[model samples]
Target: MVSIRSVHGSAQLLLDVTGGVTDIVEKMHRTIAREVNPLNRLRDMTGETPVAKQGHTYRIIQSTTSLLKQGLHRSLDGLSAQEEWELSPQSLKITAALNGVCGDHLEASGNPLAISMHLRNSRGEKLQPGSTSLSTMIPDASPRIAVLVHGLCLSHEYWKGHNEGNLGTELQSAHGFTPLYLNYNTGRHISRNGRELSQQLQRLIETWPVEVEELTLIGHSMGGLVIRSACWYAGELDLPWTSRLKNAVYLGSPHHGAALAKAGHLLTSVMRQFRYASPFALVRHTSAGIKDLRHGNLLDDDWAGVDQDDFHPDYRKPVPLHEGTRHYFIAAAIGKQVWDLPSTMLGDLLVRLDSARGQHSDDLKKLSICAEDCRVFEKLNHLDLLDNKVVHEQILGWLA
Candidate 1:
């Protein structure tokens, strides 16, 4: 057996194997190398791009700035203020004006980018930051469930209940799709999260006394990436649920890669020039995914520098999507005001038309409805789409 010394998530791994210790060390070193380098060439856009890499970067930055304002919202939590929610018409409009200014960054200067998600985590709770494995409450009879894996900094709680009904609960009750929320640390490599999601899903499938026949998934923002992580994990596990997966819906999911992630990647390098940040920043720049420009949960996920897997375009490039049983892409587009109306798509004010649309997704048949006939609730923001009355209905309708 070979012993390879590694430091990932505070675990000192002495992996016992058939090979001798020297061989293990060499393999481990190679893994580290792959883990460290993703884009040999930075700004490596596809052969067919609507604009230049720098142009994409500029657009992405503008879109990112728009979303950043929402992140910066004086969040009592990721919801409108309680008192504000109860305001009279006049006060409501006033508060809206105030929030509008604060929220304007996402709308005006473009969107700010992040790579992580924020959900309230309690001590000792299984749903830790970057957590991949969770055991659901084993109801007497197996219940159909859909697992929601968020993209970047957002966590399970990202799907909040609006008007006594949240996205998860709504999916289960309205459509018999039980909701299993997964929260993983976004700072880790995509492949690490992918593997972890596989393990966790495997555990979920094996534990179910009765088979869960139909399964669906919805991912928002980077959470879309997390869903892919889980699905890729499913492929690795060869679990029944992987194929049992009936449909997948992505709202503002960046199937390829987000220019903002690249932007944040660059910003981290700049931040480093001055001083340290959030302790986690020191190790962030080691890899492109690790740098986590948007909504980062640096404290969670054990899969950072330690995991030795290459980053795939399914991890980076948005379009030319990988095939799936029933892969559905629902982009939240934020367009500029035209002659008489606002942009038909209003993504959470974070992700924009191009990024969310996965313009470059792999060679899957790009549907015209891909952008036009989508279930559009034009006034709603990105996150709002998950719980927005019409949006949830739209998700349910899509499954139908």
Candidate 2:
């Protein structure tokens, strides 16, 4: 069902978008006007002269937009009487995509569209730790637990493909491990999710129906970063769940950083230099989560006080793999072979080969994953790593 909050959130987002576009158009007009008029241009360039005045038409448009926004808000408040309505699957997908883009804004505005982190069953039902309902949900719980985390903008449902077999089911049938899925808002900072995941895992372990003897973590893309971040926080907080963790598998994870995110940051930075282009840059404000992917930020300290849009060198603190856990990394490339240019330049079409393998030129930044523990698959894209039989087999092999 679609909550009333979603409706209110959507309305607010539309207003914000239209308002931003209007501002952009007005700014562009003003910039053009200043350029065509030498006197106004000189005034803008020099502090001694007064700034150019805005056009009367632009002022009228701004006032009209404000009035419309206010009216919309008043109208939406009336609909609050109806708490919820049917929400389609297509709408869910759109909401997830929106969260990936501007989740921080939605969260800050208290929009119900923002997703919260939770543990879900294979059926996509929420699982609460330290509750009898957990045991009721999974009557046949096993001693060994395998926690699977999906990537950005994805839910636990991503793991269930049309294929005959999935990694979770295969693990259950072969290794006697019970599989659980972690569903979360991919637009939040990795560190924040990580900290929460750590606490959740602790509660799950403490409340498990059966004693958990071994724990395995598997993550794809940004999910892997969250797992790493969680492990870091677990150590700092001395969480007992860490003791049960034995294996960690990273599938197409950008341990160093994602190439596409870096490129986006660069483009946004360049666009901000021009007044005409600057407004366009503001059209799509990326979330703090996406910004963290620029350098695989796993700690709050990485971006606590820094301006994300400004060009800054990689100053992220190095976080090595856990001491007692066996770490495995899987990297994918679009090329037919590992030596191909595409494989080296565009690993999986999103992450770079070196970054996926956690191989950095700087010794301090490197994840130091053993060569034997790392595997590279050619001719596969990023999402392909999720359901491909070969990839599943490789993960199973690593866990074995």
What C-alpha lDDT values do all the predictions have? Answer: 0.46, 0.85
RMSD of each: 18.4, 3.3
TM-score of each prediction? 0.52, 0.89
lDDT (Cα, tens digit) per residue for candidate 1, span 1-400: 1111101100211111112233334434433433466442232344232223344554465455445434444332233222222223343233223222222222232222111122221221233322333333333323566777665544454466445357776666677765666655554555555566666666666555567787676777666666665665565466556766777777876544454554555555564453223222323324323333232211123234432222212222222233545666665444433111334333435655544554433444232234433443455556666666766777777776
What TM-score does prediction 2 earn?
0.89
Residue 3 in candidate 2, Cα distance off native in Å: 5.0
Q: Candidate 2 on 1-400: residue-level lDDT in tens?
A: 5567677778778866776677787778767777677687667655433333455555677788778767766777567545654345567667778887888877776566777778876555689998889998888999999999988877677777555467788899878898898877888899999999999999999999999999999999999999999999998888989999999999999998899899999999999998778877852378888999999999999989999889899989999999899999999999999998989888899999999999888999988878889999999999888888988888888887
Worst 10 residues of 2 by lDDT: 46-55
What ranges in model 1 sit over 4 Å off? Answer: 1-136, 140-143, 162-164, 266-324, 335-348, 361-376
- The true-structure Cα RMSD of candidate 1 reads 18.4
In angstroms, give how far residue 85 of model 2 lies from its true place: 8.5
Runs off by more than 4 Å, candidate 2: 1-3, 41-90, 162-164, 282-284
